[model samples]
Target: MDLHKPPAGPPAQPPVPASAQPPARTPEGCLVVAIRLPVRIVVLVLVLPVRMAWDALVVAGRFLGDAVLGPLGRALSWLAKALLLWPLIGLWRYVVVPVGKALGWLGHVLLVVPVVWSYRQVLTPLGYGLAWLARGAWAGLAWVYACVLTPAGHAVRWLLKGIGTVLAVVGAGAYTAVAWLVRFLIVVPARWIHAAVLVPTGRAVAWCARGVWRLLALLVTGIGVVLYWTVRILVVLPALALWRWVLAPVGRFLAVLAREVGEALGHAWRIAGRISSAVGRLLGTLFRWIFVEPVRWVYRTVLTPVGHAVRDAVLRPAARAARSVGRAARQALAAARETARQTRADLRRMLFGESLPREAVGRREPSAGETRTLGRSTTALTKD
Candidate 1:
């Protein structure tokens, strides 16, 4: 399968650009136009200096980051790797790894193996013995519960039931006697006192209380009526008039002024941004003409030519000489290596004589008779 092959489909068309898709614009009023112009003019005047200052700060920050901070950060990173990272890596790899492996092996042999052996040989059998003893104890408990405790529990329950019945009968007789005595001695006397003496006294007291309450209600009503009119004339009416005639109108006017000021500030800031951009471009052009252009011209016309001449006249010849020396050194080293290999081979042959050559065997195909079947064994144990 050829994975690099393109799909058999039509190429996609390019998307429409944002400039080609213009948005709808709403119409504005004369008031907005009048406000916008003056607001924008004032805002532009105010914001231009701030925008320029901000741009200057941004440029300075970028220059510092590129020219100073980037190189410093890279140098620090390299120093940290050399001083801290490399040594730690070497220690972990060479020292810690070997020691950890040795400790692990020792733990497995001296501690883990013995613990595992003890658990299997000693603890496992002990647990089984304990389990067997527990089973015997449980059976004894079950027998005792069934034979002795169950009957004893039944006898206790019956005895408690008989005692409870007798107590209930006695409690019922005592309750009836107490209820009879309370009704005659206490309840009858309280009922007579309430009917004969309390009833008339209560009725007289209630009549007096009603008359006092009526008198008090009339006085309170008269005072409340006077207070209502007095408060209405002195405080409530004046407050309402102030709110309607003065405060509400003032608040509405203030709100309108605030809205206009907010709108003016917004328009002014946008205009200021455009003005600042134009000023920045003008300054940048002037700077390029005054300083950058001359420097660029000098570098291109004079320095470039001088540098080319120096490279051709001095550096090229030196580089050629260095290359020649390097080539000669490499050739000499290669010749020395070849001589050493030849010397070692000659000495080995002198000491051990020439090695014997092996005979080459021809390849052959197996016959039908030599091919083993499922019923016949071809292994060494049953070979023919």
Candidate 2:
């Protein structure tokens, strides 16, 4: 009965309070999210056309300004060039070139004029003076030749001829006198001197020879006695003493000297060895750095390429040429050898058609009796 009465009424539910609500979650410690590259790329793509259009507008405006001003700039530049070049060209043509040409002409004029004037004035005067002096000298010489030299020459000739005749006569007389005098004086005196001095000298020499022989005999006897004693006493004893006394000291000194020399040599050798070793090491290092390493590097880096180039461009051709030359030379040599062999055979045949017969050759030889005679003659010559 109650359910039938409430059937027309709606049911109601209870509400939750505000204090029972959960707290909101916050992203304070979370990593920042990044935008996708495609979105950024889309944005860039969207702005790129505008940027391109703006850039194109800016370039067009700059191009218009440049195009408008370009001829003006060129005109200003041309005016400046003209301003500089006109004055420079004018200066060169009017001042520098003309002045240079004038200076060259003036120098040539100065040189030529001075030289010509000097030649004409001073040198001509000096040459005229010299010519006048030479003419005067020639005239004076002619006068002297006519006046003094002619008479002097005649007188000198006369005197010379007279003197020559006199000298000849005197010389002949003197020669005769000298000959006679020399014969008389020299020959007579020489003969007398030879007779006198040689005869006396012969006697004296005979006496001196006897005395000298006696003296030499005494001297030889004394020398022999002295030599015997010296050999027995002085020489032998001194030599023995020298051997006994000096040899030990000499040997000792020599030993010490040899030892010192050996020690010095050893020291020098050691020092030299050390020096040589150090030098060798230094040189080896230097060579390695300067020559060996560089050469190796060049061989690797530079020489390899160069060698390859040479092989390609030069060496291969050279080798091929050499081979060809060698082949040609071999062929030439073969031809020459064949020709030589043929020529030698022809010469041999021309020289000798056939082998000589032994009997004919023997018959060409001398006969046995002739050979025996020749041998006997040779034996006689040998004996003589």
Candidate 3:
């Protein structure tokens, strides 16, 4: 054997002759072969209408997207560009750029150069001179304050202080003299008058007032006593006798009569109240027997049973039926979603000329346990 080549095994067997090979056999049973024609017929009949409708929808969708919507979108885009872009380009080129350049040139000439020149030549010198003047003026003012005005201000302040001290001393002494004179002339005299003349006059006047008050009190007392005896003799004794003899007996009789009447009236009021109470209770009993009790009977005997029957026989089953319908709709929607996902995968493969990438969908079929659980749930729903 060569170094690069592997060692050979036993020699290959010769090809089998065609006549010696057994023929392939068909696996179909008798029943399947017998029913095959009917199955094919039924399948074809079902598929024909679906195929026609699919072809029509595909053609219509393709025409709308490729012919109508494509041209309309392109034309609208072109019109939008024509409306929006051209005017902006023209304005920038013909108006805005030129105007901006002109304004820039004018500003450079009129504003920028003048400002630079004035700052360098005019404002610089003027500001320096004004600064110098301000410095000189400040120096002058400092000299006036420190060397000339300060000592003069001190001397003037000393003179003014001396004058203020003199005025204060004179004012204090004058105030003291005037105060002493006021005490002698006004306060002393007023005190003497109050102590000597006013006190004695007030005491004499108070004594005379007391005497007059006592005299008036005695006169009033004498008059009151005289009036009391006169009224008793002339009026009070006669009135008392008349009341004792005439008015007292009449008042007693009237009071007794009023008390009797009050007692009778009270007794009649209580009797009337009792009768009214009895009548009210009787009417209330009658009303209950006639109306409210019958209403309660109908509700308890008729309406309640009907409501229970309706709920048990009609509403509960109806609710279960609605729940079953909802469950069926959800199952159908899930099936449709899975079908749509498969269709999308097929479309992706067709459109992209690519092999299928995901084996997850193929592997995602429910397990046997899950299928049994689903069947059990479906059976339960049906039974319900």
Candidate 4:
């Protein structure tokens, strides 16, 4: 039989008896159900003990934590008291009390001096000067007003105007006389005197200037020689002595200052070293008491118990659950791989004309054996 040959019979139809057709089965619907009702009940039973243990552990952890923290809180309270209370007491005793007493004494001493001294020395003289000036100015203004504004003042003003006119006429005559006298007597004689006096005065001034210049030059040369000798004897010798004296004092002061500063610095360094050592010891003690001991206690009392409880209860169960999930996932992956491999093999067999498994290709009724053979023959024609 040819595998590619078509069927010769007509198609037959099934009789319809159902009210409705059933839904088609999908690939997802073919999956096997692994978690059954019994497994779900077993999972619930296993989780119950873990939850109870976790709740008990949480209660125990809270109790242990409170117990550990209680001592630490009290210690912190004592530390705060030491840091704040002692310093406050010292400030009140040392600083505030002494400052108050000193201020009170200074205030009492200040009250002893005359309070009016400031006003008398600083303000009263200035006030008196101002009053005197104001009185004088007022009196002068009153006298001027009386002189210029009264009836007698008008007559006196007229008399003064007449006297002024007479004086002006006299002054004009005197000025003309003085002008003529100056031209005749002063100007002519002044010109003759100037001409007569200038030659001798010039010669005298030149002689005096030459004499003065020579004297100045001589004095300057004497001064220069004297200053040179004086500088060598007096200025230079004294300057050297003063330099030595100044340097001696300065060097002594500097040496003393250096020694004092060295001593001070050494003392400060010793103090600082002592303070540093004390601080280091204090910090070490604090660390041991505050951090190390408490941490050790917490680890032993609270954390250890809590860690053990969590490991036994929640962590162990969670780890087992994760492992079970991983195993299930691996099994599912393996089954899926097997299924994929089987499907690939079946598809290969179908497409490549290979025989499939008897289960995959269903069994059918036997029919007559019909075989056909194909042959090829050659016919030759010869020409003579």
Which TM-score value belongs to model 1? 0.61
* Worst ten in a row by lDDT for model 1: 360-369
Worst 10 residues of 2 by lDDT: 28-37
Global lDDT of each model? 0.89, 0.76, 0.82, 0.76
Model 2 Cα lDDT, one tens digit per residue, 1-384:
455654566667567677877876555322112223333445454545555455557767888779977878899889988999888989999999989999999998989889999999899899989999999999989988899878878878888898788789878887897898789878988898888778987898899789989988998999999889878896788888898899977886676555545545445455555555565578669989988888898789998898899899998999999999999999999999999999998999898896666664535444666564544543444543
Off by over 4 Å in 4: 1-225, 244-247, 355-384
lDDT by residue (1-384, candidate 3, tens digit) is 567976789998999999999997657556545545554555455555555455557767988999999999999998988998888899999999999999999999999999999999999999999999999999999998999999999999999999999999999999999999999999999999999999999999999999999999999999999999999999999999999998998887666555545544455445545655566578779999999899999999999999999999999999999999999999999999999999999999888888757655533444566554544553444543
User: Residue pairs in steric clash, candidate 4?
Assistant: none
Clashing pairs in 3: none
**Candidate 4 residue-wise lDDT at 104:** 86
* Model 2 residue 266 CA deviation in Å: 6.8
Task: Report the C-alpha displacement of residue 161, candidate 2, in angstroms.
Answer: 2.5
Off by over 4 Å in 1: 1-41, 69-115, 139-169, 197-225, 309-384
Tell me, by TM-score, which candidate is best.
1
Error of 3 at 16 (Å): 99
What does candidate 1's lDDT look like per residue over 1-384, in tens digits? 777977699889899899997896667657656666675567667777777788778889999999999999999999999999999999999999999999999999999999999999999999999999999999999999999999999999999999999999999999999999999999999999999999999999999999999999999999999999999999999999999999998897676556667877777667666777888799999999999999999999999999999999999999999999999999999999999999999999999998789897743533567776899776666767
Model 1 accuracy (lDDT, Cα)? 0.89
Per-model TM-score on C-alpha atoms = 0.61, 0.28, 0.28, 0.32
Backbone clash tally (model 2): 0
Candidate 4 per-residue lDDT, tens place, 236-299, comes to 8888898798888888666655554555554545555555556658877999999999999999
Angstrom error at residue 63, model 1: 3.7
